[model samples]
Target: MIITTAGRSPSKLVMKAKKLSTSYGLSYKERGGVSIESLKEQYQDDIVVVGKERLYIAPLYDESNLFFHPNLAMIRAKRMFKGDEDPLISTAKLTEGMSFLDCTLGLASDSIITSIAVGSSGSVMGVEGNPLLYLLAKEGLSSFSSGNHLFDQAMRRIEVFHSDHLSLLQQTKSDSFDVVYFDPMFHSTIDSSSGMNSIRGQAVKSELTKEVIKEAMRVARERVVLKDHWKSDRFAQFGFTQHKRKTSLFHYGTIELN
Candidate 1:
């Protein structure tokens, strides 16, 4: 992919884009308001540099602008701390000082929330199979801020890696983390899955296997968590205790290790 700046691009931004391109082994071009064909000519694909940390997927379709931030996840986490219940925390039994490994960090929303719940003492590691998604989440988590201390700290605490979950799980030591989590793409898409369209094209489309769950069990100290559609058979297939709140479209399942 090629890196370029916006119409009002400045020297600092241009330099940043060039640096990022070099670091990622991608080509760099200087242009603004360029045609889609022009972007395809040099970079093959375009990754626009917006702001110091923001990057948008071009040709925005149906309001599916792809950018990364810890806003959604951190908001949910704050609410959860205020006596509100979140499916992720309830399912994983998350608490302060608990370590977690997010095997499928699509947009890193869940991972960010986990970091918040775990606080400063705990650690969170996220793995993304797609290089593009990893770059987006990793950079955003490190650089973006929501003007909220908890949000910023949560974002900074996440350690994201670009790799497949299965291999990472296999390489992890036994009970390395308090919780192991997965949120793979669904077999069918739903409207409630907001902002997912932008990621579907680049997300890992693999179905979770029994062996994967086995490895997760080995790596988790408290439980292995899975988030999926309520109707999905993955919970049963993977031997999780399924939980679905009233009127909730999604399901949270967990296999307790202790």
Candidate 2:
């Protein structure tokens, strides 16, 4: 894949793009008044455009640009501050000083919320298999500001990695985190949000296996959680106790270790 700056790019943004290309070992292409479409056709590869606000990945086929956005995390955070409980927090039994491992870090919306629930005393790490998606989430989590100090801090606090979840889980020590969580790609489209659609094409699509659950169980001190469609059989297949939420398209399942 090649990295380039947005149209009419400033020198600073160009420098940033070049730096990212070196850091990630991607080719740096001078914009030269070429459109993303032309760039894709010429290079026959995915293009990462470093914009002023976010890094957009323009696929060779898909018209939608995949970039990082807080998505629903910002809303959930506001509700949490208003004394409303977040479903994931409730399902994970998260507290202020807990640590969370997010195996599937799509755009990191859940990770941001998990970070908030864990607070400064807590730890949150997320892993994404897609390199471009990882870069997008990593950059956004580090620099994206919501103008709310607490929310911004939550986004920034997350530790992100570009690796397969199972590999990371295998490397983790037993009881390493309080909660180990997985939110794999849904079997069916639950929400067709533009952001989700953008990620769906590039995000890793892997089924959770018994080995993964075993590794997660071994690594988690408190519990192992799975977030999937309400109708998914994974809860039963993975020995997770389904925590069904009425009127919700998805539900959380947990295997409490303690």
Candidate 3:
């Protein structure tokens, strides 16, 4: 949900955010010249980015915590990919000369990883529907660049847009991407005890319908990787042949197009 805080200028917004942060037990930090707070209250899930315009937060599925914990990417890599340094970097197949389109660029983790994999020779375009998440991911990517090898690659290779995935896909040329990746948010009525509880309240509990998958397929030249919960049937209904990799809380399924 988008929450617009009252303020006309960045300074005013920063002031308001400072006040809000104090209420939520979080300290205020300056990001992009704006004072921001990661709101863990009001919304129980997803990282909150409070800006002058609005506070954007996406909900996390209960299972999402298993695969997407902020610090577990490397751990997941060791288990899922058999000691590969980072699964996202490999799952993306982001070689030096290939282009990638991350359709559901949620946390932008995939985009960041792919950007590094592609190096300076290729580009990674990430589209995120939520403005708050986009801003946070952008900032996070910026911070990550300080010590990461992909610092230069991310600067040169990654481009982010705030827009719906469907509309974004339509604007791309056919076969424009060597890989089109999706990590669509899935719906859940019953909450699980997995690590995702912190972000479950903010997650968008709707799966990407078959129509969306078809569009992703249409744009991808090489393959489409659809990350899903173990229980979801959306992938099967969309006619994707699955290759599964088990993680702590969810599975990574790849659907190769004909």
TM-score of each: 0.87, 0.95, 0.61
TM-score of 1: 0.87
Candidate 2, residues 68-149, lDDT tens digits: the string is: 6675788788999999999999999999999999998877888999999999999999999988778888988998878999
Question: Residue 117: error of model 1 in Å?
Answer: 1.0
* Span of 10 residues, lowest total lDDT, candidate 1: 186-195
Please write out the lDDT profile of model 3 over residues 1-258, one tens digit for every residue.
222233244677677667656644444545543222333343444444454434443333332322222233333433533535555556555577788888777666556567656767787888877544565555445434334343434643578787788888878778888888887763232234343354444444435767777788889988888766767786687765555666534455666665
Ranking of candidates on lDDT, top first: 2, 1, 3
Error of 1 at 114 (Å): 1.0
Report the candidate with higher lDDT, 2 versus 3. 2
Question: What's the lDDT for all of these models?
Answer: 0.77, 0.87, 0.58
Query: Which 10 consecutive positions of candidate 3 have the poorest summed lDDT?
Result: 61-70
Selected candidate, larger TM-score, 1 vs 2: 2
Question: Largest lDDT belongs to which candidate?
Answer: 2
